[model samples]
Target: MSLAVVTLKKGEGRLLKSGGMWIFDNEIASVMGSFVNGDIVLVHDFDGYPLGRGFINTNSKIVVRLLSRDENTMIDEEFFEKRVWDAWEYRKKVTDTSSCRVIFGEADFIPGFVVDKFSDVLVVQSLALGIDRYKEMLVELLKKVLAEDGIQIRGVYERSDVKVRKQEGMEPYKGFIGEEFSTLVEIVENGVKYQVDVKDGQKTGFFLDQKYNRLAIQKLCKNARVLDCFTHTGSFALNAGYAGAKEVTGVDASQLAVDQATANAALNGLSDTVKFICEDVFDLLPALEEKGEKYDVVILDPPAFTKSRSSIKNAVKGYREINLRAMKLVKDGGFLATCSCSHFMDYELFTQTIGQAAKNVHKRLRQVEYRTQAPDHPILWSADESYYLKFYIFQVCSDR
Candidate 1:
């Protein structure tokens, strides 16, 4: 039995008993026997009974992130294959999706790791030291998992560019494991098609998490002039154009994304009414207001301003500022579809932020709908920490 010593409170063992993974430093009763970072440890309650075993990182606030309970389940090639295969099997049943989260740590019973499948290609992110150490088996398991599913081998691209890699002591790694392709990927979302950039695009090439929200905004854009702000790939604009929007404009800071959006617009033959602007979204709003520009529908889906605990307050301010400026450009009785991708800031904080912005502008706001990540990113009930992305569809009201 992989044994060291870490202590938990009297009743605190309950969560661990229920297969919970996290063990905060403060929750520890004490540590006995020296355990280096990422070494396996045997956890116990006050009574000194074996609770479970998992990897321990004394340096992290999360002192321990449990990997497995049973000692017999060796942390070897077979161990990774079992978990990877299980995650793959679950996704196949749940998703009719072309792009999906093949592994959602903890929810899929494997913490500190995640894998997203974009058609035949796989993107793996190792978020924990325990799982990060198992990279060899993990990759091997992926290959075997693909073989089992009969997906022809392409290559596994490791997009470990996320800041989470810092905790795992891993450097940023991205690129194709095998032959890379020059062309973009073709994926369908809610009957609308998109070409996703596998290598350089954001968050595993596209915000697949926001797949449903884009479609919801699409339904409201019919016969209306739509403005999609911070529009990476012009998803909202393109969807609106496809759903019968009169005209659509997508604004972003990146010329690359603007060009990608333009190419995407051409793909669907909607370039006639669709326009892409490579300019700052913040700057464009006031200029649009000055030019007496207005849109029947507005979408404000910006990149997350807050990525850590310290930046949450600033992120809220940024959210409010953007929403306030955006609300001013919306036509009376027009809809504003906004979203927050920062999981550190909860929905309550975001809603209140937007609510205050609306009040300051003296605009009546009615929430038309709420949206979250598509079904592929399932929330584990035992641990409700899974919910991250939130979208709000609101209608602004003036004298009209």
Candidate 2:
């Protein structure tokens, strides 16, 4: 059967031409041939030049997500098996495979779908309708690929309940992909153990992208007082305790998070030195400032303050305020670890915001190092969304 042809409007596919996978709704000039949404279609330039093959969906602003740049490539079982094999091999080389992102959406060349491995289990999230149809096949293929390495996947779960699915004209969904199993799964990273709730916890149960960033702060925490703000599940605080920090206090507004963090502290046998508090970080930071409490190391790992371009101004203010307060809480010559997970908050803008915060507090920052999301979450150039995390470590010094 002949495939449908989608031709782009003149000068409208700049992003796609620049190695991006998406063709926005306004970029296409015409669709020739009959096909349903999610069917693979041939894409062409305005001059009738063959571009590639991609799945089309009029329901999304991102109308087409390219699957193969080779015009002759077939989108069959063989094609998907290679994609799975390649993604798995890349992770084994760059990150610890026990628990890590196996496929990172567009970065791994599988647009709008993500698969994360947690111990012997798999969690899949599909955000695009075009990819949604292939979710089960990809999951099965992933299992087959992992089994090649002698790894047995015990269960597969789906966490496609994100709001973005609505944009694709699909309803949110969550449940087991295969046979039901215990939803509570434990995984270790940087020597810290966590109980991941795959059924109900936030965004695939845990934030694995910060795996290395959490490890980076351990050297600075030994025998020092540490404060971890927005310490969800106590990953950083426990790392500090594991490093022999004199005292560690982790604060978060969610009582459930605080409870889990406290349990994790006990799980690591650090309950004596590490503690958790349930309170608003924004409110608690000011009260702690008033109390004149200081710490040798302060870590701020707040959730993304913005998810869209329109709210970037407010996100800037939020990042600046939290950073300024956290800096004040750090004693002179002490360490500070801060990060922003919002991709909309670009590197330049985030750095400028932190600099403004330091200036406002009369603190001079000596750069320690800068990092981004873990290697498993590879950042594909031209697809800026893949590079969301920006982490920085610094030595906070009092101005003379």
Candidate 3:
């Protein structure tokens, strides 16, 4: 069967040529042959040089998401199995496979689809129509690949209920992919146990991307007072407790999150040392400052302040405000761990914002270390969107 061909305009396809998988609508010069949206299509340069094969969708600005650099490559079960196998092998080499992100969208060379494993359960999120069609096959392949390593998957759940699906001309969906099982799954990370609510919890239950980051805080928390803001499910706070912190306080705005976090603390036998509070971090930080309360370690793991470029100014202000407040609450020579998970807020911008916050608060920050998301979520260079997380640890000291 002949495949539809899409030709890119001259001087366009720069990103695609530079190892990125996306080919935007504006980059196309012309199209030949008939093809339906979400169908595999051939991509070519303006002069008719064959580029590769990708799934095309006119509904999205990202018109084409390349699947392979070889135009003649078959898009079948065998093809997908290889993708799944490679992703799993990479994870085994770099991260603990007990529970981690199995596929990280474009970074894993499978764009607009994400699969995160929580113990024996797998949560799949398909954001683009092209990948949505193959979600079932990918899940099955993942199960097969995992079974090769003696890991049996208990169930599969779909969490494609994101607004991004609407942009792809597909309705958001959520539910079991196969047999229904308990949505609550327990998983341990860095000696901390968490009950992940795959059905109602945040994206794919818990934030596995911060697995190592949570572990990184343990050494700093021993016998120290620790404050964890935006403490989702007490991951960081519990890690601090397990590290034998004298006292730990985790703050979040959602009562549900606070409840879950509290439960996790008890699950890990850290309830006595780590306590979760249902309050806005922004509001609580200033109140804590007024009470002359200071901590030996302060952790700020706030959600992305902005998802788009337009809202970046507001995001900067939000990051600056919280960081300035957190810095002030850090006792002299105390450690501060802060991070931003927004891809739009690049590393340079986030670092500059932290610098600005320190200056405004009259604090001297001695850099300790810098980090990003865990290796399971590999950052594909030149694919800017694939890299989002930026983490920094600094020692906060009073000015002379």
Tens digits of per-residue lDDT for model 3, 1-400: 8999999999999999999999999999988999999999999999988889999999999999999989889988899899989999999999998999999999998889899999999999999989888988899899999999999999999998898899899998899999999999999899889999999998888999999999999999999999999998999999999999999999999999999999999999888999999998989999999999999999999999999999999999999999999999999999999999999999999999999999998999998899999999999996999899999999999988
- Find the 10 residues in a row with the least total lDDT in model 1: 175-184
Clashing pairs in 1: none
Q: Which parts of model 2 are misplaced by more than 4 Å?
A: none
lDDT of 1 at 266: 92
Query: What root-mean-square deviation over C-alphas does model 2 reach?
Result: 0.7
Score every model by TM-score: 0.90, 0.99, 0.99
RMSD of each: 2.6, 0.7, 0.7
lDDT of each: 0.81, 0.94, 0.94
Error of 2 at 352 (Å): 0.2
lDDT of 3: 0.94
Native-referenced Cα lDDT, model 2? 0.94
